[model samples]
Target: MPAAALKPKPSNEPLPTQSTAKRPVPLDTPYAPVAKRPLPPGRPREWYVTHNRRLKAMRLAIALLDSGVHQPDQARDETIRSAARLIGVHPPSETTCHMVRALMRYAR
Candidate 1:
């Protein structure tokens, strides 16, 4: 390795200064997180699949809206998937993307 490579780069971060008193965060009523309650036992397989897909579509729609995509026309598959990753959910399937668009269409 060249001698130049041995030198450490300076950090862009400023040296820590004594923090001032933090202002109280404004209270905004945000959406509540999913309830911890488990799904009831013994549902049919297809019921669960449709149920989960509905949930995923709803989440993706909300994420897209939050990211300023207000119209169904603006919600392409890739756009919905990007929103999925942003909200920390699994990427939605093609069908779920369709459902998200449907939800957005209905909401307008």
Candidate 2:
């Protein structure tokens, strides 16, 4: 019978990792300008004027709500034009700008 032999224990040191040995590549080389979809042609003057009006109206509505005016009392669905008028914004509404009211009602 062969004599009983004592085997050595496994090493406690961490195994060599690939990330530490690999060289990193540089990413800042100048490349051809990426093809981007061209922006839509400029809009008519009337379009710009209307867009500005909508923005103004929306802002006015937000301000009115912030000011705590007509808290859930008056008709909240009033057009942006009307709300804008109430909040002193002018030349309102190419389209009927219904108020996009942001009410935060906490659940009971």
Write one digit per residue (lDDT tens) for candidate 1, span 16-83: 68343353432233445677667778999899899989988998887778678999999999999988
Model 2 per-residue lDDT tens digits across residues 1-108: 434455556775546653543454332332233345643569887886666555554565555454455443332545434555555546344342332333212100
Off by over 4 Å in 2: 1-41, 69-87, 91-108
Q: Against the correct fold, how does model 1 do in TM-score?
A: 0.67
What TM-score against the true fold does each predicted structure earn? 0.67, 0.32
- Which predicted model would earn the best TM-score? 1
Report model 2's TM-score to 2 decimal places: 0.32
The whole-model lDDT of each prediction reads 0.83, 0.46
